[model samples]
Target: MILTTCAACAAPLAHDAPRCVRCHTRYCNKTCQHDHWRRGHKQMCKKIHRGGNAEQYHADKKYKEAVAVAVEACADDTNGEEDFSTLRAAINYMGSLIQLQRSEEAKALYRKTLPVARRVLGESHEMTLGMRTNYAMAFCADPAATLDDLREALTILEETARTARRVFGGAHPSTRNIEGGLRQARARFALRELLGQAVPGELAPPEPQLAAAATPFAAASAIAGHLGMDPQEANAAIEELSELKARDPEAFAELMQAALSGEGADAGDQDP
Candidate 1:
């Protein structure tokens, strides 16, 4: 026989009571019944507590539980294969759970997630990188993730930015923005590490409006440096690029092809 329990408290409930009147939990007694509804369990409680196809509700619940279980299972293994999609879902849902102030459960989720992220992404992929960024936020969410944890998270972000810059390009949006952030996080971590305190504005805040924001000219300058060219040469190449845009616009539709193809200032370079 299946034991029915209160959705809210997980206590055993009476077979007859479908709706918890007090806490809106499925319950066995008038007290559980009255307490469920009487304690201001009107809106969200009612929705979660009642009126669904039993089999389907159970199935959906089971599916989410399975996902949670898989997340834990993966997290538990010291050396597990990368499961980026599952890690992404776990990060998102765990964030939501944290926002709801479900701290214990959220921490458990994070524990499982962090190891999987480290193992699978090898501390580099954007997903793992993103979670590193999120850890400080999780601390901000709960205020209990020790100062050390936040510092470690920021360290990971710095590494992430470096990897992005090297693997992608200085001009690529992710590389540019995240590298900038890594610089900031490094500065902050340095201060806190040395001085044992957070300094204001030490961490470079992410660009608020990434889409319309102008590309980082400094990155272009850096690329020029990396390629052993002066800023003027870079500008000239960019000017040549503008001319290319006018003549063969479609060739450089989504990106500045000169940068991507590394044909900077090469007169021989053609769109086709």
Candidate 2:
């Protein structure tokens, strides 16, 4: 939920806020956790540890469970109350979704909350900025993320990193986190450029020339005949992929994913 504030005492929590090992509760430190334990968590903690608290259980780790909880919580209308904790819960649940590799769902959550966050927290507020970070990072979650997607992510990170430095100072935790995100985005961008695979398009030329045959079977036979005739060339082409894998593992993996999706004929094309 925009973890700028501590979960226990409402104090500002830095980037490295300590968390309860068992339930993953964030705290400013041992004192806050201890105080919270005395307040009521002494029992709540036990319930979570014993798996009796479904909310706590869902909130901590499971992907599908977290999605269910977030969906249910978001369904509750706070009726435009700015201070409602349910909104925060929704935002935090998006983070959990992203953490668990449910990026598509996280993207949907960010799209919904980004406008609301801007209205409630203002554009430059920490919570809004955090959402921006989450939105940008979400684009990178899919294994089939395109070059355009990575570039879009990089653009958002670059702007977010710059604004974070200006508002929070370079040394601030938020600024540092954005900077790290920028680095990863850059790496993805570079990989896309360097690897430039060809994703197939609708306009792909006819397969080695089944183009001018009278019937489907004739074309199929012609192609089969050529396959027997040019077995060496086919073997060479297949080995090229292995060479690519040995040379650059990351790009090769990206290419493999794209190829498996039948996108290899025009993967090199970038989005406008």
lDDT (Cα, 0-100) at 116 in candidate 1: 76
Candidate 2 achieves a global lDDT of: 0.60
**Best candidate according to TM-score:** 2
lDDT of 1 by residue, 88-198 (tens): 777766755544546567767667677878876776676666665555445434423334655765666667677877777778876775665555444333323321221
Best by lDDT: 2
Distance from true location, Cα of 49 in model 2, Å: 24
Task: Report how far residue 148 has shifted in candidate 1, in Å.
Answer: 2.8
lDDT of 1 at 132: 55
In order, what lDDT does every prediction score? 0.49, 0.60
Q: RMSD for each model, in Å, please?
A: 20.1, 20.1
Off by over 4 Å in 2: 1-81, 197-272
